[model samples]
Target: MDAYSGYNQIFMHPEDQAHTSFITDRGLYCYKVMPFGLKNAGATYQRLVNHLFAPLIGNTMEVYVDDMLVKSRTADQHIPNLSAMFTILKQYKMRLNPTKCAFGVASGKFLGFMISQRGIEANPEKIQAILDMTIPKTVKDIQSLTGRVAALTRFISKATDRCAPFFKALKGTKRNITWTAECETAFSELKEYMGRAPLLSTPEHGDILVVYLSVSASAVSSVLIRSKDNAEHPVHYVSKALQDAEVRYPDIEKLAFSLVVSARRLRPYFQAHTIHVLTNQPLRQVLQKPETSGRLVKWAIELGEFDIHYKPRPVMRGQAVADFLSEFTESQASAATQHITEPNPPLSQDQTPTKNTLDLTQPLWTLFVDGSSNAQGCGAGLVLVSPDKVALEYALRFNFQASNNEAEYEALLAGLRLAKEMDARQIQIFRDSQLVVHQVNQDFTAKDASMTAYLQHTRHLLATFHAHTIKQVPRSENSHADALARLASALEQGMGRHIHIEFLAQPSTQAPLICTIDHSPTWMDPILQFLQNQTLPANPAEARRVRHRSARYLIINGSLYKRGFSLPYLRCLTPEEGHYVLREIHEGICDPASKRLAPRQPRLLPCRRKTHFRGARHLLKLSAAKPNLQDTCRHHNGLHKVPHWNFVQSSHFHFPINKEQYLGKTKNHSPTFTVTLPELLLVTDLGIGERSAGTTPVSEA
Candidate 1:
């Protein structure tokens, strides 16, 4: 039952009520009862519930903050359970909303889910919200869809993997989304799945709960199960989209990640019962190793509290586990190659590569391309197999948001580019995206301007090969590439399973210049000379001095920089630049229009220092366009509020802070975050429009 004005039900301490008063035309007034804005209102209400329901909790009743439920084994006992709860409510002067509360109900919705003797199930309304919805066109629409999906993720299998395509749509700065074929297929499938969504079972005391872990290219999934009468039923499904460095984790790590996530989400289950992790991987050995990677040790420690045991998976016992097995099965040819549905028998022994060998001849290269863009993020996965049957897996993560179609084209483009780099003359491309294949073959007209551009670029790239053929196959046939795409699009979120995966900062549509007009030295030459050549000035004394100063020196974006004792990477400026900076620091007094400095008396030290310390950027703030800061601030706020983070934009920087901490910082650091601060800390702008020379990272001495 729902509480009546739950937070406001209790009276505040007489003296404290005055603190909550608001100003008005009338004399000051305060809340006699606890108000909604009280810092400890929720916690205080929870304490009251715990106190009142102490005996009934976990036996006949379950109370979560203001929401309470009474359960009984028999119909006759139901009345007594209700009476006992009501008796306590009366003693505490507690009230329930008559319209919100129900009596003698067989089943009902609570805490955004439906609970009953049949076990827990996702709310029908939540499922219908996605099903009844039209295709999402705006960023907000896609965001809304993702939000609904997140609420029901526990009921959905491989939830992160399945919804990957939507995340791709929200990537990058493109405001208008490209709703592609993959999204349409996924949308239909999601609705169909929701139409008959599985009923989640609850584990009974002493039940030996088993967890089946499944790790895909871009997601880690686990299903918590309990057996009854020799039949297995799912208690909960957990999924997480891996990002950044997490994507590079080994297979065992991914498995561990899945288990860790499951344990975290179902902490109560772990605390109460023993959990058997069913997997072929050596999870325990890795976690229990004397020495291991930092994250593994961290994950191991995180999972240390759980009563978890690892064991090899037995044969699939139920349809649900069977489904998990099917989605995550890898091919023999490439351990990294994941097929959504199991493929037919191997083509031949020649088609499989042996260790320590690759023959790049035969003039034929096979390409499988699949693109997934979902709420976790958008990415394209491609498996390029050379003539010798050696698979070269490339997962291209778009630096920006892309639609499914755009992602498909990206995968195809990336695959062709890789093959071209390998100097492959002939190619046979296989993709699950029918629209992209048909468009490339001129069978389907490129109706949209974006697709037309993509199709044109694809054709242009395909033309580089001596012979190339494109075919649209069933999704199952292209599962390997599809998995690769999902992995690529949602990279840095999880560890990579098989072969090494590479990320592309941008799409082929916005191709960068492959060749530059000239390659020459600039400000970086001195540092590069000192580091690489170990050469200093001709004079021995000056040379020794130059070598000494090079320790903290770094060349960033064609300019020299020094690692400041306190600051990070301070720009090393030339005399001319320093003069211009000093002038800009005196922006108000020094007129840029006049060639000579004004013959005016200088101000006192403190006043002059104040203006000087404000820096040139702050002084000239009115002249510079800082739409980036406003857009960035808005994006930052939107990111915190998003239920599911869309990794559509490939290179959104992730700081050490988590989402919760970020929100806290946002609130405390800047209540009015809309106003852009001065760009005092500028990224390198050497006046050179583009990079024209080879680059290397700065090494701190």
Candidate 2:
């Protein structure tokens, strides 16, 4: 059943109708019935339908405002359901359009999806949109394809992974597309998939649903399935591309990430049913492990409200789940168990536990922090001991200069951060520095501006803990942390000679703010004005220079940079320097990768060979004489200072310089060639009449 002119059927209040009065050509009048464009018309009409059909709703009929469904379990009940719906419409003085109304039908279209006893099917027209599409040539075409795919993502399994190639193509330069072989394969696969897209099953009430997860390097995918009569059907398919740092996550972490993505996307389904996460990995153990860090810990806490269970994925039950079954280095076998449950939810930030209301007498974490700033360098070290005695040792070496007291503050801050990641409810910190401990405990005032900023940040993090304390310990008492700090300080000076050391670019209390400068009337402005608009500065010399300069540099997204195949976009160099750069790349003397290859070569070593290691090393450049330079290097590290070397490596046609040229050896018998910058340039300009003249072998005098 359908209500004809549904919004018009709802009458406006007699008194309030005056506000809606509008001037027409004939006369000024107000709407007695609710108008279609009025903001409240649809809601008012829906309210009327809901009130009139309250008894029939969800029983023999389903009403969504104007469009009404009079459903029945049997043929006999259909007539009664229609009669009940018609009576309400008549009493409410609402008319039904005969053309739009359909009665006693088993199936029909409600939303965009088709509805029937069999299941919900994708709209045929939507699927046809994809099938009819030719190969995408531009960004817009790929975008259109993705849009069409998104509308029916529930039916298309691993949708993100399937269309990842299209996304990659789209991410390239917008003006000119480089559609590779990968795109063709993916596009064909997409059309084929959509042609035979699966019918998404609607889950029945009280039926337990299963979710199978799949994690690839590029994307995380999951399929929600409902079991009926021993047959599993897919309810929804979820797939998301892993962006930025997510791509670098460990295999198990990626699995957890997939579950988190699925949970957030399918929150409504998760809230409605007991979802069993089917996975062969120890996902439950990883997420629930006591040693789990803050990232996974937060994920587990988010899923706390739902009755989500983890179980070993069973044999592929349906064709929909075939994609979920992975064959890889990761072991799929789990101990034979139907359900491996998680422990009860931990106390999240949302759960506010007061000391009085809730007994906050649990043992707090112990932190030992120390900082060193002697002649060696500046560094901080900390050891975080959980209530259970698991100790986490951390050291930070600072790149920027910091004082002894500042280093002490850094040590304290690092300890707090590590402790927070461990989800420590309470903590007791011991620091060797009296000034740091005193400042944190408010026993000493922070006079310096930097120290004050650090103090505020420290207080903010400390507030996150239920209860935390800090006390000053003697240098001897905090020996372990002190030693760790000394080690970090020594490592900063490159004296440790062991282990992977991380340098802290900035202090712990401060996060670097990246602000992009939109400089007006930049160096590129006059150049761009000349090129695009043919407008330039009034002066003839300046205008001519602008026109000349525009040729060497191209303005891309409002930044002036020197562009060349041989050089990096040089933004750091001045215009004069950039001019010299262009000359070098075009004129046989540009070592693009070497920053020291400036016009003057400020920090470069002298061309004269150092006699300290006689004939041990040689820098080779392509000579005008050698068409096929079959040079070899076993120890390339010892070689340096030759121009046009980057060009030789990049261009395949540039003199056939063998791998040995770059990776040459001091220990090998392979002949080496040493040529000065001026000599190399002369060699490039003129072909070698003889080897003795243009090219000089290192083995010879």
What are the runs in model 1 whose C-alpha is more than 4 Å off? 326-701
Q: In candidate 2, how many Å is residue 700 off? A: 99
RMSD of each: 27.6, 26.4
- Provide TM-scores for the models: 0.48, 0.46
Worst lDDT run of 10 residues, candidate 2, spans: 627-636
Worst 10 residues of 1 by lDDT: 598-607
Candidate 2 lDDT over residue span 586-683, tens digit each:
23344232222322332122233444222123222322333222121222233444334433344545434566654453224323444222244422
Q: What lDDT tens digits, residue by residue, belong to model 1 across residues 1-701?
A: 99989888888898898788988898787898888876788899899899889999999999998899998888999999999998998998998988888888889888989998999989988888888999888989988988998999888988887789999878845688878899989888888888889989988888889988887778888888999888998998888998997777766677777787888889999878867887665566566443346676567656655556667788887766765774254632144333111111222322321211223443478888888898777888888898889998777676688887887787788788788777676788888787887777766899898897897777767656556677779988988888777776666646756756666677776757787556344444555686445555677565555544554554553466655545455775543454454444333333232112211211211123244324323423532454533332233232222223212222555332366665565566566543433311223322212342443232222
* Total backbone collisions, model 1: 37
